[model samples]
Target: MLDPILKRIASSPVLIYILRCCIGFLIGYKLYITYPDFELFWTLLSIILVISPEEKDTRRLSIERFKSNFIGSAVAMVMLLFLEPNVYTIIAGIFVTIIVCRLFNVLNMARVALVALLIIMVQPHQTGFVEAPIYRFGSVAVGCIIGLLIVVLTSIIFRPLKRKFGIPY
Candidate 1:
């Protein structure tokens, strides 16, 4: 009876997706609490943004989003280093991120890039204005890494379940 119930849950893609998200959240939360200096909201947000229900999408999107994140971080850091961290700086970061995304052919992923720019730029200047961008870039990078690792681990765990249950992609 329990085996049948377990099979039912395992066979449903929606349930599997929910489980994957729950796992990501748990990991993200742990990281959020574990490190004091890390701007872990980006980490949590990235996991949600990067993880996909489809394995292929998870692999593809993660790389693209990482590139987007990199662009955003680079733009924010450059702008903050030279200019004040104000509304004008954020506006410039957005435009810069968009342009960079287009040049890199990742314009479709500009939303995530914009988010990265905002997070890095808008976060409270706890460590000071100049250091904020550097710290946030590290946070975003960690987020991308965690999201990719979660995708790989989930794929490994789910493959056997998919095979056993005859689940379609």
Candidate 2:
């Protein structure tokens, strides 16, 4: 009876969700403690949530994420050079970023870039334009790395029920 119960618990979907949540929380917590920045850690968590490889619909989602991030960042940077760092300006920047990214067919990258740029631009510090871009780039890089790590780890552990799945990495 005990062995059957144990087997049932081990094979439960709830157990998998609980484990994934724990791993994500732990990773997010460590990132927050090390960086002491809410933006960075939240970005990492969002990436993990959105880009999970355990899902059957991952291919398109992954491509979209990459594209949005790339395009969004580029649009955000270009807009930054022309606008002051204010609430209204930030809103306008975001609008412009999305529109431009959509128009240019690189909306995935643009969306990520826009968020990164907004974080840098809205901060109180007078970090120069050069430094702002660098930080934004760095944040995206960190988010992507964390997201990829989450994907690989989850895939290896869960072994999703896909008919055919292969990752070259």
Candidate 3:
């Protein structure tokens, strides 16, 4: 039935990547428009970052980015509690995030963490001082969670079809 279609689609790496990107963009754009207040570009970017041509890579990247985003968000929230959101503060946050990522063995994905840090620490103060960081952190978390869910769900749906169709895992 649908297994043949799914297998055919999964057999081509380029097709898989294109399908992932298309789905990611649709989800990201929907979130962006639905939540007009949050800095959802971060969410969109995170979704894009989590998607890979291979299911295994997608899962791994989602987990890594989720952890990196959490580290960055926590550092930003703590730093904002004490210091003002100045250029120097952002620079300091970046330094701290990089060090933390290296310590956690996520230096390879430090760029994603730094982006999360910047999103939280360098806002335009549209929201209340305390609420801004919280909102940004939530948005980042939503992106990571949604991206991971997509990977998990897709694997669940496609794995059996792939196996039955004699496609390589």
Q: What is the C-alpha RMSD of each candidate to the true structure, in Å?
A: 2.3, 5.9, 2.3
44-148 per-residue lDDT for model 1 (tens digits):
877776666764466677678878987887798888888988898898889989999999998999998898888788867677776778877887777777777
Model 2 lDDT per residue over 1-169, tens place:
6645544433554554466556666776677688763345545544554353335534445555655664555555555666666788778878877786678675645656566556556654334665565555455555655655555575565453221233222
Q: Model 3, range 8-58, lDDT digits (tens) per residue? A: 887766776687678878898999999888778777877776665655576
RMSD of 1: 2.3
Q: In candidate 2, what residue range of length 10 has the lowest lDDT sum?
A: 160-169
- Which consecutive 10 residues in model 1 have the weakest lDDT in total? 50-59
Q: Of the candidates numbered 1 and 2, which has the greater lDDT value?
A: 1
Query: What is the clash count of model 3?
Result: 0
Model 2 accuracy (lDDT, Cα): 0.56
In angstroms, the error of model 2 at 136 is: 3.3
Residue 154 lDDT in model 1? 70
| Runs of candidate 3 exceeding 4 Å displacement | 1-4, 53-56
Task: Indicate the residue-level lDDT of 167 in model 3.
Answer: 82
| Model 1 spans > 4 angstroms off | 1-10, 53-56
